[model samples]
Target: MATTPSSAMRSLDRAFDVLGVLEDTRQPLRLSEVARRAELHVATAQRILNVLIERGYAAKEETGYVAGPAAVATAHAFLVNNRLSQVALPVLQELAATTSLTASLYVRVGHFRVLIARVQGRNPLRYQLPIGEKLPLYLGAGKALAAWLPDAELHSLIEQSAPFTRVSGEHVTAEDLAADLDQVRKAGYALSLSERAVNVTAVSAPIRHAEDVLGALSIAGPSSELTETDHTRLIGEVCRAADAIAARCP
Candidate 1:
């Protein structure tokens, strides 16, 4: 019998999952290790690996398997075709000019968010996130992404974001996160101050296509700059910029 469409899609998903595992580790992995991390049986993994190897998306090393030239080409294609960066570039520049604070666009990667575009602030002492910087979804400006994630994924990210030992007593409970996300969804923006980096403050708003979130736009600066009056003004600016980006997107 021929494989059903759903079964083929499942296999495809497993194959992609194996690639993701390898990419995240940034090193060659044995078939058993890939299977364990990807939650696939060794045979299933080997089958996927065969296809990946044949396609030049993965290659076997003396150690194990690593992403091959095709994977780099795929990533390059992704960068070249990035709609968000295209839409966000000019908007980010305008936002930086308007706010006199650093503006950035962050896209959610699995288990993290990556800084893809940025415009520097006028101030010399501003908080800046360079392009390609990756950050956890639980802290600072990433609350915008965290707020809109599905419940199960949010919980999974929350667990991945923090370690068991919270010597600083900063462990966040599901209840607290739930409340925080509620406010973010309600207000259509996220504000985090001194949570991840002490003495830094960020205001972030989601960029969306109707209800589907594309990413987030954020303004970051020293905590001292976020006074009551500044908070009201900056949040509005961030929201407007985010809306503009969303309007430009699909």
Candidate 2:
């Protein structure tokens, strides 16, 4: 006797849900976290995680578990095949080649953003987004992505993280971030000096296909390499690349 299609589908869905929780945080998450996020009992989630770990879809770390190497490969395959990445990767490649900086494309997923495609700078010291990584709404490259979000959504995100974010030099409060978002809206780009990491800096622009905000295009490198002048110049280049990519989006 063979398993029914519905039973297989149910198993598949649970597996995907387990995988999604790991992907969303992009950090090693505890078993409780995965269970809570997946809306499954701890024992059920643990069983799924064990299977995922056995198959390399998830890994166990000191803190918890993260998406594993096989999951990374799947994300790379998606980047190679996705319409968004297909349209945007060339632009990112050229930008990285010309600027000697890391170029990245991020698309909104649920309430967060996922890195779908990226081109790396050759420099030994450079920023990296190695696929299947998710980003918060109020951080570096995320700032440009966040600018276009609706008022209610944006407010919710800010209110959630504004406390820890206030530790940084740039955003001291939700109001400060709101003001920065306003600037991102006006200037058509966003820049972060030390928002995420102390020495990594980035400039980013929005990717819009028609009326919908599709994603963001960003160039990142060491803080020293991206000077004020360099940062200003990259803003225009990033925005231009974004428009070109958006035009080709299917």
Candidate 3:
């Protein structure tokens, strides 16, 4: 019998969910684990996995199941075709080299920020968000892009993640988030020290095109390195690099 449209759509959604779980975990997973994470029945997940394996979107391994070459190829295709990533690579390299800090580019997706490109610094930090990872928009460099969002969206994100604690052991409230966003608007950049991770410090500026905000450009490194560096100078470098990337983009 031929498949119905609604059933096909449901199957597609399940497949996507399984794919997301595999990619997000970044590790091999047992079939039961995949089913639990995808919120599907074991049999349903196995069926989806079989299709994915045959299509080279996933592979069955000795340990478990892992994302296959096709997933990587798809991410590569997006990066190669993405104008923002293409335009920002050289600038990210320059910013990382000049500032001696890791430089990254982030694009907002709903309530999350996704790292699209990054250049490692001379000194690596203990914590790093790899390319293609999605993180809450209220974290560190994410606030730079989030600052320009409309009030409703911005407030919603703050409410979701506020009343939280930083990796440095500081508590954050909604009011604190509102105040910080105001500061970001006033300064045209965001500065966070040990906000997301205990030893990480980040400075970020918005990348804008005309009146539209595109994303963010950020430099992050170990907090200890900043004790001797001028915060204002680092902020300036980040903002300049962000502006350069914005100007170069169409």
Candidate 4:
């Protein structure tokens, strides 16, 4: 049977709705939760999720459905191959060289931030984040990008990424994470003091494209080297690099 245009449109809309819900949640969501958030029937949600899973856009887990690697790859292809990285890399390198701290580019993919590139400083004590590592959107430079998102979207993300626990074994509560995000918004930057890695300190600022905040640029180093004064200076440098990248983005 020939597919009707109206029916096809409806299916497309539901598929995108499912994707949007998954993007906001950032973690695997149960089928029931997905249906509730997408405002679709359970059967309809299952059908759409099955299609997404088949196409490698979503993965079915014990808890629920989560974004798959293909989804992240598509996002990375757009950002890494685009002109933003080209424009940002040199500036990031300069920042690292000047501050003797590691500089990196982090872009949000789904509910996580992926480090797409890094420029290492001469300082042997600096922390190193390998390219392609995914970090929670509530931490470090991830929080900077998350804070710049629309308020509703940011709130949704926080709710979805709740029970925030540090990968490094430090305990971080959702309320504390929200408070930190508030500071990031007011200060126009983000800071992490051994939140992700012990003895590492980081400061980050968002990179904007037109009206959309695309990603963040951050500098990291040993906590001992990044004293209060150095942290402030790093924030300034990161923001300047972000501005330079935004101006040259294509």
Candidate 5:
């Protein structure tokens, strides 16, 4: 019997799911483990894995299965082509200099936000996050970007990352996340107090093209230095920088 279009699509999805599970592990994964994680039958997962291995998207190791170099190349291509990072780095550097606090750029990837670039401030106590690090989408600057996503994409993200959890002592629930997003939409910016790390506070604003928000830019520092007054001032500066970056986009 011929496979229906929907069935074929589901098979394709299962193949990608196997690849995703392997990618997250960052190491070889057992076939049984991959089947369990992908929620597919063992035989079905085996068939998909075989296809991925044949195409060089995955390879078999002594321990299990691992993503091949082709996957890494694809990810690198994405970073090189990511428009937001290229356009926002100079602005982030300027913002860091002006605020004397670390400035960062984040974009959502899959279920997390990846820090693509950051500029450290001159202050000895300034906050710093390593580039290419993945952060939870509901915390810190990542949350700000997730909050401003379009309704459909936002809901999809929320559903994919449901049952919110605490990060660095900040309690978060889905309702709280929705409420915070509402506030961000109204204020045109977002702030977090030690949400992702202790003794750190951050202010982030959306970067838009025309009317669509594409990503977020944030400035972070030690709470002692980023006082209420400083927070207000940084918010204004970050917003202005974001606007300038947006205006320059083609």
Candidate 6:
């Protein structure tokens, strides 16, 4: 039987879903776990996994399955070719070195921001995330990127992501987030203390291109260490770094 276009597209989407599930994890995942995460039936996931293994996009381990060399190679291609990563690498490195804190660059993806590049400080966080990890745009440093969005879009995102719990054990309402974003816009930067992770604090500034916001740049460190530093200096450094990156970009 001839495969219909829609059927072929479905297969492609399923393949990508399976691949995304694998890539999102740091450890190997059991077939059942992968199936569950991908929202596919066990039999269907097994068939997709088998094809992925054959194509070297995934590998079967004693415990389960993991992303393979081909998947890594693909990510490497993106890193080397992505214009934003290239443009921001030097600025992020300089920012991290100057602040002695981790510097990261994020770009919006849907209602989330994905970390695309980073430079570690003298004391890197123990729980270091991979480059492609995504976090909510209404959380922590992401507010810098979210602040410049259209009012309707900004409010909608806040509405969707509100009622969040911070590491401090306090709940954040949509009104709180709206007020925070307004401050970020007025101050031209965003600051968060233990909002994304315990003991982590971040200062972020938007990277603008002409009248549009391109993304956000941030410097993060342990709350105790970062708080000891002059807040004014840290904000100045991060905002200047963000501007440098934006200037270098197209």
Provide the overall lDDT of each model, using Cα atoms, as 2-decimal numbers: 0.83, 0.82, 0.89, 0.83, 0.80, 0.89
lDDT of 4 by residue, 117-231 (tens): 7888888443455576778888778988998778788888888877767756766667876787888888888888877777888889999778888789988888876679877
Pull out the clashing pairs in model 2.
none
Q: How far is 36's C-alpha from truth in model 4 (Å)?
A: 19
> Compared with the true structure, what per-residue lDDT tens digits does model 6 show for residues 1-250?
9999999999999999999888778899999999999999999999999999999999999999998888778878988998988999999898889888899999997788989898999978868878878888988879998999998899889888887888889798888889989999999999888888998888999999999888899988888776545677999999999999889988
Q: How much RMSD separates candidate 1 from the native structure?
A: 3.8
Ranking by TM-score: 3, 6, 5, 2, 1, 4
Model 3, residue 117: C-alpha shift (Å)? 2.2
With a 3 Å backbone cut-off (N, CA, C), the pairs that clash in candidate 4 are none
**What TM-score fits each model?**
0.76, 0.77, 0.85, 0.69, 0.83, 0.84
**Strongest candidate by TM-score:** 3
Model 4 CA deviation exceeding 4 Å by range: 1-80, 124-128, 167-170
Superposed by TM-score, candidate 4 places the C-alpha of residue 181 at a distance from the truth, in angstroms, of 1.0
Worst window of 10 by summed lDDT in candidate 6: 223-232
Question: Which window of ten consecutive residues has the lowest lDDT sum in model 3?
Answer: 223-232
Per-residue lDDT tens digits for candidate 3, residues 33-132, read 9999999999999999999999999999999999888987898898989999999999999998998888999999888888999999898676677788
Clashes of each: 0, 0, 0, 0, 0, 0
Q: Which runs in model 2 stand beyond 4 Å of their true positions?
A: 1-17, 24-40, 44-77, 122-124, 166-171
TM-score of 6: 0.84
lDDT of 6: 0.89
Of candidates 6 and 3, the better by TM-score: 3
Runs off by more than 4 Å, candidate 6: 122-127, 148-160, 227-229
Q: For model 5, which pairs clash?
A: none
